[model samples]
Target: MARVVTKPDTLNQLNQDFEQQVLTVPVFLNSVPKCGTHLIRNIFRMFVPVNQQYHDTFIQIPVLRQHVGAFNYLQPKLSWGHLLFSDESAMALRKAQHLVVVRDPYDWVLARARFFLSDNFQGNLEHLKSGQINLEEILNMMIFGIHEKVPSLSDIYTHNAAAWLGTGTKLVRFEELKHHVQNLESDDAEQYFRELLSVLQLREFPTDWRERVRVGSDREQSGTYRDNLTNTAFTLPDQLPEQQRKLVDYAAPGLRNLLGYCD
Candidate 1:
């Protein structure tokens, strides 16, 4: 298994600051890897009681059966994972409200490459992080993937996001989530969150929702937040290069459009 080194967050301690509501149905925050998983998970943590939050592990296919209790509807919990679409996963989440988060493929390529090269990520690809590989090559590896070591952009998005599209899972775009978090005071942001939180089935949106969101979205609290990543040697381009952007399209045709990221 790949190891990710992230600092323990005080969100649990912070979670106590709010009057949390017990969930009636299990709420699963599913996402493509690197699609603001921590940011969304942390925000939901603030709204749910710590006792009801699944702290076991980030549930995935291989170890899913072991942690299937995270989706228990009777003793509801708030859980999150990079779960791919599968018979077992579909069955497990049958009684749970599932939210599948995704990012624009163009930006997702950049995010994936950035993390793979950071000190926080210790995996088989460490050889590529020796500064021997140039930025463009690393970005290409992110798009096409490393032979058997990493799954390609198409593979990840296909099973993780695309396949789950019509299944009753709520699609949450990372870009939209970030925008609302940045403008929480606006009426539009309020409506965005109201709908987002509706899956939780909270009796009523809490009065302190804004403050909870503010603390949960704090960049310092997320270990994987771009600026928080340590020892990222490459100076990645702000946007994917035009050629690489073309490569992304070829790698995952119509992905951006399907995910509502159309130009």
Candidate 2:
């Protein structure tokens, strides 16, 4: 794993002391990769009344002191990016009562595929084509949903979801959001989410929250990669060997499951 770069003189003692300071309810909105984290950030930005700083990546979440520097410095609340549930993050979540919004594994992987295929991550292209990983095969799982007790898309999704679900953390699913929003219920996805912000005591919700509803919606249409993710080839007896399957399974069960498979 890569390092969390920021550290100061007497860093260990300082962080230990800081962690003990009993931080007020801080919002540690972990923007999961390709999980409509953008929409979530936008929604939170609407509620937080004061100026805030945000990062383009997850590296900042674990080292809050270096970037956000405790909630006391924050005008209202700060939204952050995808972070693994390490002790530093756990401490922040404990302080803030962070709400985790999880997309069904299928959709999660599909969105990731779009981002993965985009130009920003060109460095990964060589590895993927070399079979160090296979982005195309993995994405098909996103067309459907994760299945239990079997080989699936990437294993990473399944394992990752299991970690999130298994933890005592509070998680809300994207499906619930989609159904509620599409049905136009009184307690729609937007409303459900706004309530979380309120629970975190965000006095102001962006009026634009309503507008995000339209911008956030996605429908799975036929033959449309932009809409419908084509089913992935997770049933890998057809192409992948046992060793390869196990490799992917061990490295990325949650990722696989997110693509809607159980390998």
**Which is the leading candidate under lDDT?**
1
The alpha-carbon lDDT assigned to residue 248 of candidate 1 equals 96
For candidate 1, give the lDDT of residue 163. 98
lDDT of 1 by residue, 1-263 (tens): 78999998999999888898878999999999999999999999999999999999998998899999999888999999999999999999999999999999999999998899899999798987887888899999999998979989999999999999998999999999999999999999999999999999999899899999999999999999999999987888889999999999998889999999988
lDDT of 1: 0.94
Give Cα-based local distance difference scores for all models: 0.94, 0.45
Best by TM-score: 1
Off by over 4 Å in 2: 1-24, 53-65, 68-76, 126-161, 164-168, 181-191, 203-263
Q: Could you tell me every candidate's TM-score relative to the true structure?
A: 0.99, 0.54
